[model samples]
Each structure stands twice: as structure tokens, then as C-alpha cells.
Target: MLFAHDTEASLAAAAELVNTAHETPDGLRTPADVVAFVDRWSYTGRVAGDAEELAAVRAVRPRLERLWHADRDEVVELTNAMLRETRALPQLVRHDTWDYHLHAVPPEADLAVRILVETGMAMVDVVRLEELGRMRICAAEDCDDVLIDLSKNRSRRFCDNGCGNRTNVAAYRARKAGG
Candidate 1:
């Protein structure tokens, strides 16, 4: 794997969270949407299941999104800022079916803070390994989604929202038309 399981998971979750804001209808429109996101991402913590909690999580999307397009130094600055802002204290912990992984904030911390800290922790590994290029914006001509290229060849140029397939199909059709 390009990164540890937890780091990859955190990066993927962060990307999905950011893409929600880019979705046509704004994927996170309600508390239920927040709940669904947490459940999907397998985040185990104190969930308030309220509007405030939903708003807080939604507010974090843009900040995390910036990391995808940041330069190496900018990523370091933003990640360090996130860790500091969240008062992150990294510790190894095991929960649920997950093996030992780093948890920088307590489960009871605000969900938004947890999201930021988790992403920051993951980015720490990315920065350490000098793998910042793996964080990328989708290559689809009309999409603005972000993705982490976990592929061994580092050829992942599209998000998981079917942009790759769409691009491929368009290319095939254009070739057939020209032929």
C-alpha cells in the first residue's frame, strides 16, 4: 500500500467530505447527511446528531479541500495549523475492527475537529514521505473533485465519482466519430 491503512482511509474520507461541497445539490444538506457521512466513513465517536454538529462538519470541507491543491510548503503549513488548532495529541489506539492506528484527538472531540486532526495526521505521513504529489484534483475536464492517488504507479488521475469512466467513454466516442 502507498500508505498505512488508516492514513489512506483518512485521506479518502477527507476527499469525500470535500467533494460533498462540490456536488450539484450540495451533498450535505441536513443532519441526516452528516450522520450518513460519519457512518460511511466509519467514524466512531460522540455524534450529537443535531444541526449544529452537521454545520460544524460542513464548515470543515473547504479547509480540507485546500490540501489537495497545495504546494509542499503550503500543505505543511496548513496541516501544522490544523494540528495546532485542534490541539492534536497523537496516540496509538485500537477501536472497533481497526488495528492500531494513530488518533490525534479524542473520540469525544467535536466531529469537525476530529476530521481536521485526522486529516492532518494523515498529511503528516504524506509530507514525511514526500508523497504530496499523490494528493490531486480530478483530471476530468468539468469536475472539481479531489482524490488521493493510492495506485502503485501513481496514475490515479480521477476521483471516485466515475469521472475516469466518463472521460474514457468520451474519448472512445470521439475517436469513433472521427473514424
Candidate 2:
């Protein structure tokens, strides 16, 4: 794998959080949605399962999106700010089905803070490996989804939201019409 499983999972979770902000239905519009997301990601933590918690979680999208096109230094600055804001204290923890992985915040921490710390920690790997190019915005002209390019050949150019298929079909139709 291009990155460790934990890092990849964290990056994907981060991207999903950002995409939720721009999704057609506003995926995180309610507390129920937040619960669904937590379950979907299989996050083990103490969730308040309340409106305030949902809002806090939703607010981190833009901050995480900053990493999509950021340079190494910029990412480092942002990550450090996130870690500082969360007062991250890295601890190795094994809980649920997960093995030893870093958990900088307690399970009782705010969901948003936990999300930020986890994503920021994973981003440290992206920066350390000098593989920042793998973090990208969707190439589809009409989509602004964030993506992590974990492909073996670095050929990923679209989000997983069917943008690749849609774009290819559009291109084919245009060529057919022109011919």
C-alpha cells in the first residue's frame, strides 16, 4: 500500500467528511447523519450524539480540505495548528477491532477534535514520505470532491463519485457527435 492502512483509512475518512459538506443532500445535516457517518467509518469513541456535537464535527470540513492542494510547509503549519488546537498527546491504543495505532485524543474528546487529530497525524505521514501529490482535488470539471490518490502508478485523476465514468462518457459522446 502507498501508505499504512491506518493512514489510508484516516485520509479516506477525512475526505468523506469534506465531501459530506458539499454533498447534494448535505450528508451531515442532522445528528442522525452524524451517527451514520460514525458507524460507517467504524470510529470507536464517546460520541455525544447531539446537535452541538454534529455541528462541531461539520465545522472541520473546510479545515481538512486545506490539505488537498497545500504545499509541504503549508500542510505542516496547518497540521501543527490542528494538533495544537486539539492539544494532542499521542498515545498508542488498542480498542475494539483495532490494533496498536496512535490515538492523540481521549475517547471522550470532542468528535471534531478527534477527527482533526487523527487526520493531522496521518497527514504527517503524507508529508514525511514526500508524497503530498497523492492528495488532490477531483479533476472533473464539475466536481470539487477531495481525493487521496493511493494508486500504484499515481494515475488516479477523479473522485470516487462516478466522475471518471461520467467524464469518459461525455468525452465519447462529444467525439461521436463530431465524427
Candidate 3:
């Protein structure tokens, strides 16, 4: 594993969160969508399950998306800003299937705030280990989704939205046509 389990999970969650903004027809278009996302990510906190909550969650996508294309200093600035905005106070907490991991906000905090703080804390590890290269944008020509390159060889070049398979298939078709 390139990073601690929590860090890797957070990175992935952050990527998925960012990609939601780029999805066709808007992924988080309803409270139900937000609930599904929270469940998928195993987020343990107050989820208002209301329109305001959904909008707040959706609002963070662009901010988190910036990390994929940000320089080291830019990432630091953004991460720090997130932490500052949330007034994050890190503490080790173990809940559910998760082992000891950092939780910088109360379980009752706003869902959006928790998401931002958790992602910021994960970026803290990435910046500390000089592994910001793991953060990347999809290499697929038609996709603008963000992805985390957690592979040991850093070979990940596409988002998980079938871009890799689609790109490979297109290449094969082009090769067949040329031959």
C-alpha cells in the first residue's frame, strides 16, 4: 500500500466525490444521491438528508477537484484552508470496522464539513510524504474526472468510470481498421 489505509480510503473518497461533479446529469442531484454516497464511503456523521445538505456536499466538489491539478504549494494552501475553515481538531477514533484513525471533527458536525476536513487530513499525509503525484486527472481524452494513482508503480492513467476499458477498446478498433 502506498499510504496508510485511512489515507488511501480518503484519497479514493475524495476522487469519487470530485468525479460526481463531472458525471452526466449531475450525480448528486438529490438527497438520495448524497445518502448513497455517504453510505458507500462509510461516512459516520450527521447527514441532514435534506436539500441544503445536498447542495453543501455538491459545493465541495470543485474545491476538491482542484487538488488533482494543483501544484504542491497550491495543494498545501487549499488543504490548510479546508482545515482552517472546518476548525479541524484531530483526534484518534475507532468506530465500526475502522481501526484507529484520525477524526478532526465531531460526529455531529455538518456532513460537508466532515468531508472537507477528512479529505484535507488525507492530503496532509500525501504532502508530508511527497506523494502528491498520486493525485491525478484522468488521462482519457474525453474525460475530466479526477483519480488517485495508488498503484505501486504509479501506472494508473484513467478514472474508474470505464475510461480505461473504453480507451483500450477504441485503440484496438483503430488498430484493426489500420491493419
Candidate 4:
């Protein structure tokens, strides 16, 4: 694997969290949306299930989204800043069928802090491995979503938002018209 299993999973969740702020219908517009996101991500912690909590989570989307575009050094700086800003303290712990993994913040910390710290921990692996290029935004002409190139060959370009299929269909139609 390009990274440890947990790191990859956390990175993917971070992308989803950032992307949740976009797309039609607004995936995180309400308290219900926040609850849905927590359930979807399987984030185990104290969730107030209130508007204030939702807003806090939304506040960090920009920083997480920035990681998709950061260079090696930039990622390092951001990761370090996140770790410092959150006042994280590293601890190895196992819970809920999870094998030993680092949990740098208490479970009762703000949902945003937990998510950011988790992402920061994953980025520690990314920076150490120099795999910042694997984090990327969709190359689809009209899509703004982000993704991690977890494919063994690093061939991931467009996101799973049907962009690949849509692009292919458009190209095929153009070819047919030209012929």
C-alpha cells in the first residue's frame, strides 16, 4: 500500500469531509447532515448533534481541501500547523475493532478537532513518505472534487463522481459527430 491502511482511510475521510461542503443539496447544511456525515464516516466520538457543532466542522473544510494541492514542503507545514493548533498529544490506542493506531486527541474533543487531528496524523505519514503527489483534485474539466491517488499505479485522475464516465461519453460523442 502507498501508506498504512489507517492513514489511507483517514485521508479518504478527510477528503469526503471537505467535499461534503460542496455538491448540490449541500451535504452538510444542517445538524442532520452532520449526524449523517458522522455516521457515514464512522467517526467515534462525542458529537453534540447541534448546529454549533456542525459549524465547527464546516470551518475546517478549507484547510483540509488545501492539502489536495499542497507540495511536499507545504504539506509538512500545514500538517505541523494543524498538530500544533489542535494541541494534539499522541497516544497509541485500540478501540471498536481497530488495531493499534494513534489517537492524538481525546474522544471528547470537538468533532472538528478530532477530524483535523486525525487528518494531521495521516499527513504525518504522507510527509514522511514523500507521497504528497498522491493527494490530488479531480482532473475532470468541470469537477472540483478532490481525491487521493490510491491506485497501485497512481493512475487515478478524475474523482468517482462519474467524471471519468462522463468525460469518456463526451469524447465518444464528439468522435461520432466528427466521423
Q: What C-alpha lDDT do the candidate models reach, one value each?
A: 0.94, 0.90, 0.93, 0.88
| Per-prediction CA RMSD (Å) | 0.9, 1.0, 0.8, 1.1
Off by over 4 Å in 4: none
State how far residue 77 of model 1 sits from its true place (Å): 0.6
* lDDT (10s digit) by residue, model 1, range 1-179: 98999999999999999999999899999999999989998997888889999899999999999898889999999999999989999999998999999998999999999999999999999999999989899999999999989999999999989999999999999999999
Q: What is the TM-score of each candidate against the true structure?
A: 0.97, 0.96, 0.98, 0.96
Worst 10 residues of 4 by lDDT: 18-27
Question: How badly does each model clash, as a count of residue pairs?
Answer: 0, 0, 0, 0
Worst 10 residues of 3 by lDDT: 1-10
| lDDT for residue 130 in candidate 2, whole number 0-100 | 93
Q: Tens digits of per-residue lDDT for model 3 on 1-179?
A: 87878888889998998998888889899999999999998999889999999999999998999888899999999999999989999999999999999999999999999999999999999999999988888989999999899888999999999999999999999999999
Clashes of 4: 0
lDDT at residue 122 of model 3 (Cα atoms): 98
Model 4 clash pairs are none
Scored by lDDT, model 3 comes in at 0.93
Error of 3 at 3 (Å): 1.4
Which one wins on lDDT? 1
